[model samples]
Target: MKIVKVFLVLSVLLSITGCSPLVNNNPTKVETSSNGSYKALLFVNGMELQSVGHTANESELVVGEFIGAVNEKVDIEIRPSDELTSNYLEEGTEIYSVEGNTKIVLAKKENGDYEVFE
Candidate 1:
């Protein structure tokens, strides 16, 4: 359930923000629990395929800077959904792909494409 909500929110964000690559020192959200309200601030290390992200309560929100979430470059891509993304590759329907050096947040669209939230 939480995953679904996060995926949806990511989709909306990708549409609004052209999936630009991200860099270190960016403000990312931390974990918190609450009601129906859901949000995500995730970071993926493009070099190591490691990532960190969490949801926050509608009110209790915390902000901090990431030291080195992404190693070198930061970018967001709008690739075809069929393209193998990290975890999604195993299930062929997952929304995230973090197996490679470049870690990216993905949301599966109705058209079978992905909205890469970098």
Candidate 2:
């Protein structure tokens, strides 16, 4: 009986330690573009796809393979004005726009040099 109690106590301890606590049950906060400039090409499946933020205004975007190539052409538009459009950028990644003044979070990965899920 003592051995069984010890085993059960160990099992309970293991169960308690094995699980992670849940936090931040709230929805994610939306990050707004500073100066209406878009950042980071939406890299999905290893390609630069198009996306837009809701608050994005006449905001400009940089589209290129390398960071330097963005301005090799013209600025791209983040159309439709909706955060859903940019859900692909993920959260926490830093991005710069065509003019290079404003910075925003990638918030997701659409494509680019990084590997992604289909």
Local distance difference test values of all predictions, in order: 0.35, 0.36
What TM-score does structure 2 among the candidates reach? 0.28
Model 2 accuracy (lDDT, Cα): 0.36
Give the TM-score (vs. native) of candidate 1: 0.21
In model 2, the runs with Cα more than 4 Å from the true position are 22-57, 60-66, 69-96, 100-118
Q: What are the per-residue Cα lDDT tens digits for candidate 1 across 14-60?
A: 87676554532243322233654222323333222222232222222
In model 1, the clashing pairs are 19-76, 21-74, 21-75, 21-76, 46-101, 81-113, 86-97, 86-98
Error of 1 at 87 (Å): 22
The numbered model that scores best in TM-score is: 2
Worst 10 residues of 2 by lDDT: 66-75
Q: Looking at candidate 1, what is the lDDT of residue 77?
A: 25
Best of the candidates, lDDT: 2
Runs of candidate 1 exceeding 4 Å displacement: 1-94
lDDT for residue 34 in candidate 1, whole number 0-100: 67
